[model samples]
Target: MPAPTSDLASFAIALAEELPGSWTTEHHTHAQYPDQFDRAQHVWDMNLVAHAIAEHVLGQDAALTRDDGTRLYVVARPRHGEEFLIGAIAPSGIPAEAFRTVREPDGIAVPDDPVQAAADITVDLLPRYDKALAQVHDNAARLATTPAPELVVITLTGRDFHVSKPERADAVQVLLANGCVFDKDQGAFVLPGGDTAAQSEAIQNTAAQLSRLGVGLTVQPSRTTPALDTAPATAPPRTTAPAARTR
Candidate 1:
């Protein structure tokens, strides 16, 4: 794909979120057929990815496919240390029917075609999505005053996982930390779980950890933290629906 205007770092980070969504939309379409990863097609795909981000047309899974013998997953950091989307389900012993879907807040839906949907985010939509996202988060924080979740999760990428720079925080990251306890070392969240009184010690630990950065760890609880799925990276289906897309 063509090099989009997005910075390399931001673009790469966006992939963790985008690929899953786009895969869902492109899952069944022959548009991104494995055979089409040609030089020119590659450029086109890159451009589409950039356009999706620019347009805020963030589908849950845009390009995912669950066909005969293929599935995809994010396996590792490759040559550029860029996360590689490994479409290697067959060799990896995964079923091909694993990847397929684009989700709306309402439900899972498949995209018709990507080529037709490829459009840049208009200047208006970019700020609009950003502003709306910010407001939802603000509301969530306001609501946090009543009941607290078991966790307020934030997934961090890049070497600075410790989240040292306050301004560098993703808007979601800030929301998760707002009006809550925190810790960086454990890399786990202790967000107002159950009774905040019981977690006072854990909360202190979390607060201390957040004061500085450190290696990956859960600061909040000792329980296992989960990784996003290869498909849409969504929690398991809420009800019977189409197959979730991943990778």
Candidate 2:
């Protein structure tokens, strides 16, 4: 069968399509051997596959069948410019009685349909994208409760306020979320609106929040000096009255 994309889900599906029945999937990087079995045997086989791949072997396929009819199909393929060895073990032929004594979870689920088995494997192997989305939602909810900063200008001119340098990054993030903009020229953040009592209150509240983070927003005179003209001055040109125009 043609190789699938580097995505683990697609890889699982491709491996499933090549299989004849429900089988457990295994990878060299994400190997989860059954605890009930002798893990050393599986690890040895896994190492063999890895060694072959490291030697630049491609399209290598092999099968191992136990006396009980349980079989393992190992295949090596290149993934993301690196070779990876994957295996699928068919344990359907083995009698369920063989595992009756093991009360612990096998952790590997093999659905009757190979496709579903692959889907299950994919779900287990992939990162928790849903968890990440929920985290983003939580952050948004928290930001929504933060006071919307007043955009008016503060009364202090030629003065700028800043948090402690070490905490600038985190403080900047909080200020920006509350509708503040960084003024590179002023070397400090400028609120979107200012010049009212509300502006002063907003600054005080923001400062208070930053204080909890061990940083204080304090005002200081602008350190940037105005540029001086270095060029020599020229005399102003004398202008004569325009000649009288003919009627």
Cα RMSD of all models vs. native, in order, equals 19.4, 27.9
Q: Give the TM-score of each candidate.
A: 0.18, 0.23
TM-score of structure candidate 2: 0.23
**Pairs clashing in candidate 2?**
151-192, 151-193, 151-194, 152-193, 152-194, 152-195, 153-194, 153-195
Off by over 4 Å in 1: 1-120, 147-247
Backbone clash pairs in model 2 (N, Cα, C under 3 Å; residues 3+ apart or in different chains), count: 8
**lDDT for predicted candidate 2 compared with the true structure:** 0.35
Task: Give the per-residue lDDT of model 1 (tens digit) for 148-233.
Answer: 21222222211011222233344225435543434666544334434434333443344344433321112101111122322234
What tens-digit string does per-residue lDDT give for candidate 2 at 96-139?
22211111111232333334544653564212322332343453
Top model number, TM-score: 2
Query: Which portions of model 2 miss their true places by more than 4 Å?
Result: 1-155, 158-167, 220-247
Candidate 2 local lDDT, residue 190: 66
